[model samples]
Target: MDSGQGCVGLSGRRNRCRVTDSASVAVSGRPREAWIDVAKGVAITLVVLYHAVMYLDGVGLAGAMAPLNPLLDTFRMPLFFFMSGILAATAIRLPYWQLFRKRMSLLLYLYAVWVAAQTLFLLALPPISPDGPNASWTNLVTLFIRPSSNLWFIYALPIFLTVAWLTRRWNPLIPVAVTGVLAVLFGSQILHTDTPWDKMGRYLVFFLAAIWLGPRVRRMVPHIRWWHMAVVCGVYLGIVLIMVKLSLTRVPFVLLFVSILAVLVGVSVAVVVARAPGFDFLRVLGTQTLPIYLVHTFPMTALAAVLMATGVSLPTVAATALPVLLCSFAIMFALAAYRRLAAVPGIFTVPVASWVDTSAVAQRAEQAEASA
Candidate 1:
C-alpha cells in the first residue's frame, strides 16, 4: 500500500497531514497520526489471524476451532485494500516518473524477490503437493500470469498504481464507474482467473474510491456513529442467517453486496478502535506489517509441519491462536535482528534511483514556479 509516510488523523475534521520523512513512519521513525497506524495495525493483525486459521484447518491442526468464522472471511482483505486505497491518494499528485519509480517499481521488486524466495522454500520443503513445479527461471515468468501463491498482494499493487496514475487527471466519477464495472465483472466471475488480477478487479474500485474521496474520508470516519456499526453488524448477520436458512449456493451478486458492506463495516470498526486510546501495540504491529507479511509464511508452514511431525494435536481455538501469536512474535524477532544488522528493510520499501529522471524534476519545479 502506501509507503511509510505521515498520515492525517482519520477522526475529526483536520487538514491532510504533510508527508516528508523518507523512511517508514508506520512504526517508529518519526511520530505521526496514531490512528492510521492503528487501522493498519488492526488490518494486518486480522490478516495474520485469517491465514493462521486457514493453515491450521488445512493441516487438521484446529481440533475445536470450528470452521473459520464465515463472517471474517468476508472483510479481511477488503480492509487492507481499503486502507491501501486511502494511502494511494498521495500518489495521484506525484510526477509520472516519480510515481512509476517510487510507487510502481517498488511493488515489482518486492513481488519478484519474494516470488523467488517462496519458490525456493516450496521446492525445498516440498509440501503435500509432491507434483509441484521445480524451482526454475520459468517460474519467474509465471509470476506475471500466476498469483505467486501467498504473495499475490504484492503482485497486485503495481497494477493498481499504474491504473490509478493513468486516470489521475480524469473526472473522479469516470474511474469510479469503470472500477465499479470491473468489480461487478470480478464478482460475477466473468473475468475469472487464478491470478491476483481476479482480486484486482474486485479491489481496484476501493483504491480508486479512496483517491477520489481523498481528505473527505478523514473527516467522515469520525462521524461513523454507533448506529452505523449496529446496522453494519445487523446486515451482515442477517445475510449469513438467511444464506444458511435458504441453503442456496452463494451468488455473485450476493457476494458483491456483502463484500461492499463488509468493507464499510471494517472501516467503521477501525475508526472506533483508532479513537480508543492506550493501544500502542497495534501501531507497532501496523508499522511492521510488510516485513511480517513476507516472513510469516515460513513460520506458519513450519509450525504446522512441526505439529504434524510430533503428532501434537491442538483444539481448533488453540490451533488457530497459537500459530498467529507465535508467527507474529517470530517475525518480530526476525525483524529486530534484521534491523540490528543495519539492513535496509527492502521488505517495507526500496528506492529505484536508476529510474530517476534528474531533468524531469527540475523542469517540473520550474514549471510550478512559473505558474505560481
Candidate 2:
C-alpha cells in the first residue's frame, strides 16, 4: 500500500540492514531508485483505475475500462506486492519481535485506522452503488475474520510480512516452495476458499519471490535496454494472446506461469519510463502511493453516488476515460489529505501513545527480546 520502506536498522537484528524513506534505496549513499517509484506509479494507477471501474459499474458506466479487468488482474496486485517485498526484504530479516514492533505495529495501526475511517465514510455518505466497497454495517464485524472491505490489502500486508519474517531463518527456497504450492492450489481453483483469503494465498509467492530476488531485480532494472523491453513485450503479448485464444490462462499450471511473466513484463515497463526524462510525476505518485491507497476510494465512492443520483449515463468510451479521470482526482484528493493532516500527530501516522508505552515499554521489549 505504501512506497516507503519498512522497519529500520537494528543493532542485534538478523541482518543489520536499513530500510529507508525511499521504496528501495542506497542507504549506503546511493541515489534513490527512480525505477522503483516508476513501477509503483504504474501499479497504483492501475489500482485506482480498477476501483473506479468497479465503483462506476453499478451506475451503468462500466466504461471502456471494463474489458481490461481480466488482463490487468493477472499481475496488478502481484507487481505491487513484489515491489513491496523488494523494499522490505531487508527489514524482513529483523528478529521476529523487532520486525513485529516496527513494521507490523505500523501496518496494523494504519490498517485499523483506515478500516474505521472507511466505515465512517460509508456510514455518513452511504454509497448508492451495489458494487461499492461494502454495503452492510454487519460486514464490520468480520473485518478481521473475513476482511470484507476494499482495505483487505492492508490487512493482508501485516499477515504476509509476518509469514516472510517467520520463514527468514529457514532455507529461502522452502517458503517459496510452500507459498508456490498454495498459490497454485488457490489460483487453479483447486482450493475453494473465500475471497480475501483466496487472494492472499494466490499472491503469497510473488512477495516471497521479491524478497528472494529483489536485489538482483533491482540491479537488473537499470541496465535494461530498450531492445530488452521490446523483446519481453513481444513475448508477453504473444503469450497473452495465445492464452486468450486458447484460454490457457485458465489452465491449471499455466495460470501461475503467465502471472509470473506478467509481473516481469510489468517490471520491464519501468525500464522504458524510469530513467527517461519527463516521468518525474510518475515517480512522485509512486512515492506517495500509501496515501493514495488509503484514501483514493473516497472520491471514487463519491463519484458512484453522484452518478447514481444524477441519472447521468456516461459514454461507453468513458470506461477508458473515467478511470484515468478518477485516478487523477483520487490521487490528488488523497495526497492533499495526507499533506494537510500530516502535522497532526495522530492523523497520517499511528499515534505512538495509542500503541506504545513511552516509559516502560522499551525495557519490557528488551526483556522480551532477550528471553525469547
Candidate 3:
C-alpha cells in the first residue's frame, strides 16, 4: 500500500490495509539509509550530555551549565520523537491487529520492564538530587495512567501509534490541527493539569507531521543548501537575541519558536554529519539506542554517588567534562555487556514478533536486485 492510504476509524470501527510497498528497504540485509541512524545518534548523545551536566550541577560537583542545557533542550527530545513518528508511519499501513500486537505491544512491554527497573534502582540508592522527583512504589500506578519517568518516551510511542492507526484514513491535517490546538492550550497554561497527556499533546503534532511529511522531508534533507543553513542560523540567532534582551525567554511562544528552529538546525547538522564518514561510532550508538537509554541512568547515578563519596574537587569545566566522558563511557560499556541478553525478552530489549512486512521486504529485495 502507498504511505498515504490506510484504514482509519474509531475503536471497533477500523478497517485493515494491505502492505504492498515499503520505504528504505534494500536487497542486502543492511539498512538503506544512514541519516536516520545519524539523527538518532546525535539526539541520544545530547540526552546523555544533558543528564550528565544537570546531575553534576545539581550535586554541586560542577558549576551550572544552565545556558548550555537550554540550548540542547530545544531539540534533544524533539529529534527523538520526530524520528519515531517518521518510523511509525510505516506501520500505520498494517492491519490494525498486527499494529497492536507488534508495535504497541513491544513498546508497552519495554516501558513496563524499564519503569520497574528504574524504580527499583532509585530505591536502592540515595537520590541523585535531593530535590529530584521521588519514585515511590506508588508511582508504579502511573505506568497505566501516565509515564513514571524518562521511560515516558517509550510509553508515549504506543499512544502515538494507536492514534496514528485510528486516524489513518482521515485527512492528516485533522489530527494535526487538533493536537496543535491542544499543545497551544496546555503549553500556554490555559488548560492546566499535571499529566503526561499535556506532553503527549505537545509532541503529537510533530509525530503526525512526521507521518504526513516524512517522505517529503527525506527528499528535502539531501538538498539542503549552504545558504539555507545560513538563513536558518541567522533567523535563530536573531530571535534568540530578542528573547534574551527582552527577558521573554520564558514566554511560551518564544519557547515554541526556539523549538521549531532547534529541530531545523539539529536536523541540518545531522544530515551533514550523516553524509560524512567519521561518525560511525555514533551510528552504532543509534543502532542500540534502546539498550543505552534504559541503562544510562545507572551510570549517571553512580557517577554522582562517586563524586559525593570522594568529595573530589575540580575546575568548573572539568566537573562538567569529566562526568560526561565517564558516564558516557560507563553506559557504553554496560550496554556492550547487556547485548548478550538482548535475545531474552523483558531484559534489555522488548520481546515481540518481527514487525516488518516479510512480503514487502522480499519485494524490495527483488527490486533491488533488478536495479542492480
Candidate 4:
C-alpha cells in the first residue's frame, strides 16, 4: 500500500521489517543498514548519562551539576523516542493486527520484566527515594500506572504505538496539527492539570513527527553535507547553552522543539559515523542497546546510594559521575554477555538453513576454506 509518497510493503515473513531494512526500499525486503544502530547507540548512551546525573543528584550532588543538567535534558530521551519512532516505521508497514501484537507485545514483555526486576532490587536495598517519593506500596503501584521516572518511556510507548496505528490512515498533517495544538496548550499551561497528558503532550509530537516524516528524513541523509551537519550541531549547542544560562528550564514546548532538532543532529552524526573510517565501538554499543537500557539504571542508582551512604564530599561528585557512568556500562555489558550465553542456540545466531540467497554466505565459506 502506498500512502502518497510513502510505500508500505511487507517487511518480511516475520511480520515486521528488520530494523536494518526499514528505510532501504519501497517496502521490499533489503539488507539491513548500520546508521540507525549508530543513532540508537548515541541515544542510549545519552540516556545512561542522564540517569547517571540523576543518580548523582539523588545522592545530594545535584547542586554541583545543576549547570549541566538542563542542557542534557534537551536531547536525552527525545532522541530515544524519536529513534523508536524510526524503528517503529518498520513494523508500521505490517498488517494492522500483526503490527499491534508484535510491537506492543514485545514492549509489554520488556517493560513488565524490568519493572518486576526494579521492584525486587529496591526491596533488597535500604529504604531510599530516587525522585522525591518515599518507598511504599502505593508509590510502587503508582509506578505501574504512571511511571514517575525513566520507566515512563516504556509505559508511554505502547500508547503512542496504538495511536499511530489507529491514525495511520489520517493525513500526516493531522498529527502535526494536533501536536502544535498540544504544544500551545502545554506551553500556556491552559489545562491546569497534572495528567500524563502534560508529559505525553511533550513527546507525542516528536513521536508522530518521526513516524510521519521518517521517510523524508531518510531520503535527505544522502544529500546532507558535512558542513550542514556541523552548522546544525553548532546552532543546537548554542541554543542549549543559552537555555541553561537563562535558566529557562520550565518550558516544555521549547524543550520539545529543541529535542526534535537534537534528533536531526544526532541522526546526521550517526550517518557520518557509519560512513567514517572507524568507530566500531559505537556500533557495538548500539547493537547491545536493549541490555544496556534494562540494566544501567540499577547500578547507577546503587552507586549513588553507596556514595551517599558513605557521606561522600561534594567536590568528589563531579569525578564520581564518570565512574558511575562506567559502572553502568560494565553492568550492562555483563548482562548482555549473560543473555547471549543463555540464549537457545538457533535463536542466538543467524540460522544457516534459512538463507534462500546463500551466495554471499557461500562465498565467505569458500574464502574461509581456501584460507584454511
Candidate 5:
C-alpha cells in the first residue's frame, strides 16, 4: 500500500483528503467524492466482522454462520487489495528509492512488529492448540523469509511493487496472463511449498491484476451508469448466494472474476453516492481504516473471550454476528479517536526524514517562470 506521504506533499492539510480527491477526479471528474470512501469503509468492516465471528465460533461460544460468511468473503479482500493498488498507482510515479523508503519500508516495519507482538502474545498465553499444527521453529524461520498467515499480504506487497516497476513498460496483458497462470497453478494445488516465493506466487495474481487494471478501471468510471451498476451488484449477489447455498469449497477461483466485477461496482456506487449529498460517516470510517485494520483484532478477541466467560452461547447465527459487528465498529471508532488525538504535534507522529526528490515541484516552478 502507498504510504500517507504518497497521498500528498508536506502541505498543512492531510494528504489522505488530497488522495481521495484525486481518486474521485479519476472516477467522475469530481474532487473529494464520498462514496469511494464508503466502499472502503464497508470492505474493512466486513474483514473485521469475518475475523471476529471466526474467533468466537472457534471457541464454541458461537456456531458457524457459514452461508453469510462465505458470501461476505467474496469481496472483502478483493476490494482491499484493489484499493491498495489504486493508491499505489499514484505512488508508482515516484523515484524507485523514494518508493522503497516510503511504501516498502513501512510494510516491512509493520510486519516485523506485528509478528513479534503475535509471537509474544502466543507465548505468554495458555497453549491453546492452533487450527493446524503448531508452527515449528523451522516454519517460523521460513515465515520470516516468506511470511504466511494474514500478514503475508504485507510481506508480499514489496515483491508485487517491484514486479510492477520492472514490467511497467511491458504490455499490461503480459503480466495479467503470467499472473493468471500462476494463480491457476496455486489454486489447483500444483505449486505446493512453504517457501515465501511459493506463497507470493499464489497471491501475486490479484495484486498484479490490481496494478495492471488500475488505469483501465479509472477510465471506465464515466461509462458506468447507475442502472448498469445496479445490475452488476444484483448479479454479484446472486452468484455469491448460490455458491454459498451449494456449499462451495474452492469458490475463490470462480469468485475471482466476480470480485473484479464487484470492485467496478463498488467504484461506480462510490461515484454516484459521492455526487449526492451528505454521508459523512462513510468518509470518517474510510479515513480510519488503516488504524482499524491494525487494532480491531484486540477488541474483537476480547469480546469473544468475554462472551465465552459469561457462558453465552452464540448458538443462533444472529447472536454470533451481532456482537462481532458491534465490537468491530466500537474498536474502529476508538482507534479513529486515538489517531485523531495522536495527530497533534510531537505526540504520536513519527518524524522520519524522507529522501524523496522534488524534481516535479522544481519542474512545475520552472515551467511557471518560463510562461511568465
Candidate 6:
C-alpha cells in the first residue's frame, strides 16, 4: 500500500457521516478522517493482495490469481496517493524545516532502513523464488538513481512532498498542468524508465490534484450521489476492460485518462463504503497500512521459504484463496509486530534530532515569513 505507505494512520469508519473540512477531530493520537482511512484500507488491501498472489505464484503456490493483477493495477496506488494528498493539504502549509522534520525526514528514513532490511533479508535467506535485483542488494548502490524495492512508494513520497511545497505559492493550476502533462508523458512509457520512477511520474498528478482540491473535496464527498458513483465507476470499469483487452492503455495518454477516471471511481467507492456496514474492517486496516506495507512482503518471504521447504502443493481452490488468506495474515502479522516493536524508536518514524540539513530550509521559511 505504500499508500500515503495504508495511510501509514489508523481509523475505524463512521456511520455514513459526511466529512467536512472543519472536522479535525483526533483519532488514536493522530488527526484523521475515517473515510480517508477507509479509502486507504481499500487501496492497501489491493496492494497486499497483489503481492500475496505474486509471491505465492512465484514459488508455484498459486497461479489463478494472476488476472487480478491487471484488473486492479490502475486504481489502487492512485487512490493511495489521492488520499495522501487530501491529508497533506495542512502539512504542505508548514514551514519547510518543519515540513522536513515532520514529513519528509521520516519518509526517507523508512525507505533507507527498509531497503537495507530487504537487502539483508534477500542475502541471508534467499527466496526459493528469487525476485531479482529489486529485493536484493544488487540495486543498493543505484538506489540514488532509481529505487529498486517495493518500498519505492516511500522513496517517492518525499519527492512529491518537496515539489508540492516548493510550488505552494504558485497558481495551483501551474503545478497541476505541468505534472499532468508529465504524468501522461511518463505513464505512456514514451520516456520509459525504472518501474518505481515511472510510477512516481505517472502518479504525481493525482497527489497534486488532491492537494489543490483540498477541502473542496471533503465538502463534495458527502454530497456525492449514487448515480454519480454508478455512471463514473461503470464507465471507468468498461473503459479499463476495453483498453486492457485492446492493449491500448499505453496508446499515448490513454492510461492518464483511465487513471483519472479510476480516481473518480475511487471517490465514489469510498463514499459508498463509508456509509455501509460489514466493511468496518477496511477502515481499521487503513490505519496500519504503513507498517504493513513496509513489512508485509517480509512475511511473504518467510511464508514462501516455509512453503518451499515443506514442498507443500496447494490445490486450485486453495490457490484461488491464498491471496485473501495471505493478505489477512500479512495485515495481522504486520500490526502485531508493529505493536511489539512500538517501544522502539526510529522503527516506524525518524529518530528525533537527527540533522538532515533541514535548518537551511527553516531559515529560508523564516526569511519568507519576515519578508512577507
Cα lDDT of model 2 by residue, 1-372, tens digit: 641133221221222222213323343445456777788888988888788887776677877667666766776888888887776676665566755665566556666777777777777775556555445575567678877458777678778888888888888899999998888888778886666888888888988888889878877876888888888778877887777778775467676787788788878888688878888788778777776888899988877787777888756776568777877898899888877765565455555543422224433332332221
Q: Give one digit per residue, the lDDT tens place, for model 4 in 197-310.
A: 566666677777788777787788788777877988998998888777786645646665677688878888888887875866676566556556666777766666677667
User: Per-residue lDDT for 227 in model 1?
Assistant: 80
TM-scores of the candidates are 0.79, 0.86, 0.82, 0.76, 0.75, 0.85
lDDT of 3 by residue, 53-90 (tens): 77776677655464557655557776777776766666
* Candidate of highest TM-score: 2
Which residue runs of candidate 6 sit more than 4 Å off their true CA positions? Answer: 1-31, 130-135, 309-311, 353-372
- State which candidate has the highest lDDT: 6
Tens digit of lDDT per residue, candidate 6, span 1-372? 332221122111221101112122353344555677688889888888888888888778765786757777789888889887876666677767767654566567777888888777866764457554325455677775779547888778888888889999999999999998998888778878766888888899988898888578778887888889899988998998898889886787888888888888888887888778888888777766777777888888778877776778978888888878998899888888877774465666445544332344543432332221
Point out the worst 10-residue segment of candidate 5 by lDDT.
Answer: 12-21
Q: What is the C-alpha RMSD of each candidate to the true structure, in Å?
A: 6.7, 5.9, 6.8, 8.3, 5.7, 6.7
Off by over 4 Å in 2: 2-29, 130-134, 353-372
Q: Show the lowest summed lDDT stretch of 10 residues, model 3.
A: 5-14
Q: Where in model 1 is the C-alpha error above 4 Å?
A: 1-32, 64-66, 126-138, 225-227, 240-250, 330-334, 337-372
lDDT of 3: 0.62
Model 3 segments more than 4 A misplaced: 1-30, 132-134, 249-252, 309-312, 350-372
TM-score attained by model 3: 0.82
Write the number of the candidate with greater lDDT, choosing between 1 and 2.
Answer: 2
Q: Candidate 5 on 61-164: residue-level lDDT in tens? A: 44445335656654776676666665565555556776665446545555565566555544444323236432344544555675756466666767677777
Ranking by TM-score: 2, 6, 3, 1, 4, 5
Reference-based TM-score, model 5: 0.75
Lowest-sum lDDT 10-residue window in model 2: 8-17
lDDT score at residue 164, model 1, on the 0-100 scale: 83
lDDT of 6 at 361: 55
CA lDDT, every prediction? 0.60, 0.70, 0.62, 0.58, 0.55, 0.71
